[model samples]
Target: MPTDTRARMVTGAARMISRRGVDAMSLRELAEQEGVPLGSTYHHFPGGKAELVDAAVNHVGDRVAESIAGTRGQGTEHIVRWVLHAWRRILIKSDFRAGCPVLAAAVAKDERHRDTARAVFGRWTDGLIDVLIEDGVPPVRAPSVARTIIASLEGAVGLARAFGQIGPLDDVEAELIRLVAAAAGEPAPGAGR
Candidate 1:
C-alpha cells in the first residue's frame, strides 16, 4: 500500500537520522531502504528530503510524547526513570550507532530542518513539563527542571553514542532520577525522615 510505503520512508529517514545525523540522509537511500522507487519518494513527499526529514523528526518526537503520556499521574521519579530508560533502549538497540533524531534535526544546517527541530523540542519540553507539574513539581520549577533534563539527556545520548557505550547516559539517568525526586520533595532512595 502507498500508505505503508510512505510510512516506511519516514521511518527509514528517522533511523538514518538517528544513526548518521541529518547530514547523511538521502532520499534515494531512503527509498531503497523502504523498497520503494526513487520517484515514489517525491510522490509521497512533495517537498523532497525536507518534507521527509520533517516527517521523520516529528515521528520520533511523537513517539517520545506518547511515552510521556503514559507517565500521567506518576511521580517525577517514575517519569524520570521512564524517559531515561526509553532513550537508553534506543542506544542499546542501535548498538550505540544511533542518537536522537530530534537532536540531529536541531543541529542540522538547513533552516527548514532547524524550524522542524524547534517544534519537536518544544513539544517534548512541554510534554515533560506537564507531567512534572502533575507529579507535584512546583510550576515555577517544572519548566526549568524539564529543560535541564532534556538538555542533559541530549548531551548524554550524544556522548554515549560517541564512545559506543551507555555509561554517560546511565550516569545522567542516575542524576536525573535524584534531581526529579528532589524537585517533587520525595524522599531519596533508602532515606528516612
Candidate 2:
C-alpha cells in the first residue's frame, strides 16, 4: 500500500473511532472508510488494530500542534481570533457532531489509548503555554492560563454538542479572550467579558 493511502486510513479511522468509541471500530471498518483494500490495511499496519489506532492518535495530535503553531500571529488579539476561528471552523465543518479529539480519546476504555490521549493533550497545553509566555504572559502563570483556556474550549465544545447550538462557545470565547488579554496586561476592549 502507498504511504498516502495508509495515512488516509489512519485519519479516517481516527475520525470514525472518535465518533463511535474504539470498541465499535475494526480494521475492516477503517479500510472501508478509507476506500482501501482490506489486505492493504494489514500491509500498512502489521500489528493490526492497535497499531493503526495509535498511529491515528499520533497523527491527529500532530495536526493539533500544527494548528496551534499557526495561530501565533501578531499579538494577543490575533491569537484569540485565530483560536476562535479554529473552533468555529471545526464546529461548522463537522456539523457539531464531535467534541475535542483529545477529549474523545481520553474517554477511551483502554489504558493505552487514554495515555496516548493524555500525552497529546499535554503537548497541546504546553504549546499554548509557550505561546502565551512568548506573547507577554508571565511564565509562572502561563501553564495555568493555558490549561484554563483549553478547559474552557473543551467545555464549550461539549455544551455546544449537547445543546445542538453554538451559543455556549461564543460566550466562552468572549470570556476567554478577556482572560487572555488581562493575563497579558493588554488593553481589554470596553465590551470585553
Candidate 3:
C-alpha cells in the first residue's frame, strides 16, 4: 500500500476501476476505502474523478510498459509468457472480479477517458512492437503482430472474467506464443506451465 495519500488514492482508483469501471468508481467511496478524508481527494485531484481516472489509467499503463521494457533481450516468447502470466495471476487472485483498467476506460462514455485509454493502449502497442522487432520480427509485421497480441490478451481477460475462469487466458497465451514464434521465425514453444 502506498503511504502517500494521493498515490494510495490513485492506486485504489485503478483497482476499483479494474473491477467496477470508471462510471461506477466513486471518488468518495475510493477516499473512504483508502481511509482518507473526501476533502483530501479533492486536494490531491482538484479536477475530481476525471483527473484521478486519468492518473489511474496512466499509472497502470506505465507499470505494464515498464514491465515489458524490463524483459528486453529475453526473447519474444519470454515477454509474451511474462505478460500472459501476469494477467493470469491477477485474474486468479482477484477471483475473476477484476479485468484491465485500460479496457474499462476504453469503453467509457467520456471522450476524455476513451482518449486516455487510446494513448495508453498505443504506448503498450508501440512498446510491444519494439520488443518484437528486437526479437527478429520484421518492422512491418511487428505492428500488426503486437496489436494482435494486445487485442487477444485484452479480450481473453474479459472472457476470463465473464466466465469466472482462467481458461480463456490460457488459450490465448498458447496461441499468442505460437504467433510470436512464427513471426520471429522460430519454433513455437509450449505455453508456460
Candidate 4:
C-alpha cells in the first residue's frame, strides 16, 4: 500500500503544483490533500521537496509530451489547436486557478527542479520538431520553428492565464500556423549565409 500511497502523493503533487505553483505547494499540504501519511512522502522521496516538485514537473511534462505524440498526422493547424485548447481547457476548467506545472517549475529556486523543467521543455520541443517535420516542414527549419512555437505557446499561455482570457492563445495560433507554413515553404534559416 505504501507504493500506492507514494503514487497518489506524486499525482496529487502534480495537481497541487498546477493549482498552487511550485513555490506554494508545501509537503504537509500535499500529504493532507493526497491522504498519504506524512512519512510516506519521505519514504517515496528521500531527496525531499525538490524531488517531489521535480517529479511533478516530469509527470506533467510526460503527459503533455504523450499528447503531442498522439497528434501524429493531425497536421500543423490541428496540432497547434490541440496544444492551445489543452491549456485553454485547463484554465477554463479550473476557473483560472490552475496553470502549467512546467511553467511553475521553470521558476523554481532549486536548480534541480529547474533543470528538470528544462529537460521537459526540451523533450516537448523535440516532439514538436518531429510533428512539424512529418507535416512537411523542412528538416533544417523544423527545429527552429518548433522552438519558436514552444516559446510562443509558453509565453502566450502564461499571459492568457494571467489575464484569465484566451486571447493570447488565439492570437498566437494564426501567427504560429503562418510561421510553420512559412518554415515548410522557405529555405532553411541562414541557408545563403
Report clash pairs, candidate 1.
none
List ranges where model 2 is wrong by over 4 Å: 73-77, 186-193
Give the 10-residue window scoring lowest on summed lDDT in candidate 4. 1-10
The clash numbers for all candidates, in the given order, read 0, 0, 0, 0
Q: CA lDDT of 4 in candidate 2?
A: 88
Judging by TM-score against the true structure, name the best candidate.
Answer: 3
Best by lDDT: 3
How does candidate 2 score on lDDT?
0.77
TM-score of model 3 vs. true structure: 0.92
TM per prediction:
0.90, 0.85, 0.92, 0.90
lDDT of 1 by residue, 30-118 (tens): 77887899999889899988889999999988988777777777755776677677777878888888888998998898988989888
Candidate 2 lDDT at 69 equals 78
Give the range of the ten consecutive residues with the poorest summed lDDT in model 1: 184-193
* Candidate 1 similarity to native, TM-score: 0.90
- Mark the 10 consecutive residues where model 2 has the least summed lDDT: 184-193
lDDT-superior candidate, 2 or 3: 3
